[model samples]
Target: MLSIKNLTKIYGGKNKAVDDISLDIEQGEFIAFIGTSGSGKTTALRMINRMIEPTSGSIEIDGKDVMQMNPVELRRSIGYVIQQIGLLPHLTIKENIVLVPKLLKWSEERKDKKARELINLVDLPESYLDRYPNELSGGQQQRIGVIRALAAEQDIILMDEPFGALDPITRDTLQDLVKVLQKKLGKTFIFVTHDMDEAIKLADRIAILSNGQLIQFDTPDEILRNPANQFVRDFIGENRLIQDRPNMRTVEDAMIKPISVTADKSLSEVISIMRERRVDTIFVTRNDGTLLGYLDIEDINEGYRKGKDLVDIMHRDLFKIQIHDKLQDSVRTILKRNLRNIPVVDENNILLGLITRSNLVDIVYDSIWGETPAGVDEA
Candidate 1:
């Protein structure tokens, strides 16, 4: 656990890099500080570990005043990773990874074991242990830096743009790896980044900074759906699509296949299917099996009361979205139409699955929250 109270940092004469700010970070929580250039996100992070001292206020690590601890001991107790990675050029990957444990006077056997375990944890081949930093790719080197920081078995990690220098694909891969590692290790992470998208994806709770102060600190969904202020609203922007698209998510990611029902049946038959499936709509299809309309519960009931046939009651002019359409688009559609669910079809008009309003909301919430809510499907 970490706590900051009225923290302030000033450089030289008058430059206040970090203004008075305060926050509480729970154990095992991944909190990201996000802001534009010169917003003092990095400065705030550095103050926590005394990489940059605060001009006033206090920082406590697990209830002990950080200012009272020896700089070397304090740093050793907290892991740190930077944008440049800071891997030693002369050291092999194994040596770099074990540097902290070795410095902390770990046994040779212990250090060696930790090195091997960490190398594997970062997905590096065993052969990479003896390789120098220069011999590895940029992404590999970055992973080595992470392993080195984690080698000391610290409970708190300060990551300042750890994946900022890598390619997009590598960065995304590393982000996923970090999430996995965080879940397994349960360490408190204080991450600093200027990228909003990364903050949204990685942070359990995002703290937005501006003019050397925290503007908003809340779950990502909270910030997206209800920004704290004008600055936050402007920063989040109007295009919600960019904020909710999951790179790995597809039509199959959130579809409910079992709940889907076929069309072209009689009113009584469709009602039976709906009751059995516990669904509100059925996918209408022609005799040859082409999608023709959507038979909703209301349509079926109204048709039965009016003595109309299933064909007459079915919504032939129903709005449809492709399976590959962004989930956010489906969310907007549901919200606008006040619908319970939307039908997902392929390009050929073949039914795929139903996306309920709750499902779309869950996807958006998970996108902003950095983790799926309890009982929600992974996307």
Candidate 2:
């Protein structure tokens, strides 16, 4: 458990960057600190590892005072990720990830094994471990930075706007990845961000700060449903208050049956089904209704002569959404990625349905224009 009691930071003489803030974080909880610029979110976070000393109060990790511990040892015991990534350009990806382990004097064999495991955790190829950090893209390098923080298996991870620099798609992907890693590894995370959507999406609880004071700290749903005051409501923005909008709340509300076929189907049969449905793409499912992949008209045009069945030419690099995801969370992805439609699956990856661009338009239209008037009829 991590406890902060009356944590306060005053710069120079009288500037209170973090004023009388207090919160308790449970083991393995994902917490986010968010506020406007100069609101002291970053200051409060930096205070956790003694990057910035507090002017008053205390921070205890598992009942031990962090301030009393050696600063170097305290920092090395905590995982930290930042916006700049801070990967050394001269080191290989493997070497970078295992730096902490090496400092801790872990054996070479154990370090190598740990490096490979972390690389796989981020869904990167093991071959990239030998490559230099400069060889990876921005997003890939960020992934390395994330795993490097975890390389030493620290109990608590502090991330300061780690995904803020990436494009929307990459940021979204990394958010999902980090959340999954946090849950799977059972690591405590204290993330600082300015994005409410990101905070709600990733945090078990959010700490909204303002003017060097803690405004509200609670679960995302609780904060959205019952904002503490006008400041919080304004901070959250009106558009995200989807509770009042009843027409389309979740992806499941708008999903329509996808045009799909079993993976055993022949090329001619799959093509005929697409022609009948007037869709350029057709999903391929297994006998158990698991999403195998999809085949598009272009794939057929290029590989029909050599392919044996739908699985032969199907593309598995598919983007998808869960059935229970909020519509608001998915809207930006659909529009920004310019996708015609995205598959909706259940927890088990079973093909539930699909949400198309048309469905999204109708949802947005209804949210703005509302349902048809009583006794009204269309021409």
Give candidate 2 regions above 4 Å deviation: 243-249, 297-309, 369-372, 375-379
Q: Please name the candidate that would achieve the greatest lDDT relative to the true structure.
A: 2
Top candidate by TM-score: 2
Cα-based lDDT for every prediction: 0.82, 0.90
Clashing pairs in 2: none
What's model 1's TM-score? 0.68
TM-scores of all predicted structures: 0.68, 0.90
Q: Predict model 2's lDDT versus the native.
A: 0.90
Give candidate 1 misplaced runs (Cα > 4 Å). 241-379
The sequence of per-residue lDDT tens digits that candidate 2 reaches over residues 1-379 is 9999999998889999999999999999999999999999999999999999999999999999999999988988999999999998999999999998988999999999999999999999999999998899999999999999999999999999999999898998899899999999999999999998899889999999999999999998788888999999999988777533632378888889999899888889888889999999889999899998888899997778775566777899889999898777687677778988699999999999999899887777576556667443352
lDDT of 1: 0.82
**Candidate 2 residue 83 C-alpha distance from true site, Å:** 0.7
